[model samples]
Target: MTRWVGPWLLLTCVFLLMVGNVDPWNVLVGAGVAAALLRWSGRWLMDGRPPGKLGPRRVWGFGVLALAVLADVVRGTWRMMHVILGPSPGAKQGVVEVPLGERTEGGARVSALVASMAPGSVLLDIDWERRVMRFHMVDASRADEFRADMERFYRERQRAVFP
Candidate 1:
């Protein structure tokens, strides 16, 4: 009924996109396929949990978080360029563990993705039981600074968007 309309339209669009055609025949085929999937894949698609609401506030927060991540990427790239092109005698590359406090799985995943986008850093692992994230950094000497930065980001930026 009305509940399935959005998924049906989305899946139909996906089908048309994958097939790269928009003729009447393709549209009909896409709609049929979308209907069949929606009919059979309800449990698989949603599990038992209800879908999360997406309000305007959350959308705006997400946009702000994206811009913040981009800024981090640019700054990291500039710092990495210096390390790469010139002699960085102070640089110490290694892994640093940062406390992940009480983040939900989705929030932690987003943090990992955004953290990894910064140049010269990679998210190595998320230790759920330990409540920590391990990141490999080009300059482990700044581990304390890195941890502080991450804490600030999680508190100020990601908390609103993902929490």
Candidate 2:
């Protein structure tokens, strides 16, 4: 029963997103589709893994991460605006390779996601074997700062939520 919650909520979200309504008929159809999809894909998705539970600590950690991301978004937006509207449009642009360090696969994925959420940076590639993520940044002159900030974020923010 616990295993069903994640898939059911995912399917419900997708159904609502696609159909854009919650009429009774639509809900019934969504439930039927969700059930069929769950039955068909449950084995592959579950993969004999136990369901994950979020305790208070994890919840608090997630909240902290969310706030940090929001702050990063605002700061990135302001910096991007300056770069765009400034006298010089040709700001230093390059890709920075950030070592994944001891981050788990899930933690690495979340790290990439959070890095991409910033306005001027995008996740270009992830090398699992090398355990590195490549990000293209608009202001690559601050590569060292960027790398340090990413390391801190992964170590401090993402580790608790995803590790």
lDDT (0 to 1) per candidate: 0.84, 0.84
Give me the displacement of residue 12 in model 1, in angstroms. Answer: 21
Per-residue CA lDDT of model 2 for 45-77, tens digit only, reads 666642246789888999999999999999899
Q: Work out how many backbone clashes candidate 2 has.
A: 0
Residues 50-97, model 1: lDDT tens digits: 334678988898899999999999999998888788676435889999
| Candidate 1 global lDDT | 0.84
| Model 1 regions more than 4 Å off | 1-51, 88-91
What ranges in model 2 sit over 4 Å off?
1-52
TM-score of 1: 0.67
In order of appearance, the predictions have TM-scores of 0.67, 0.69
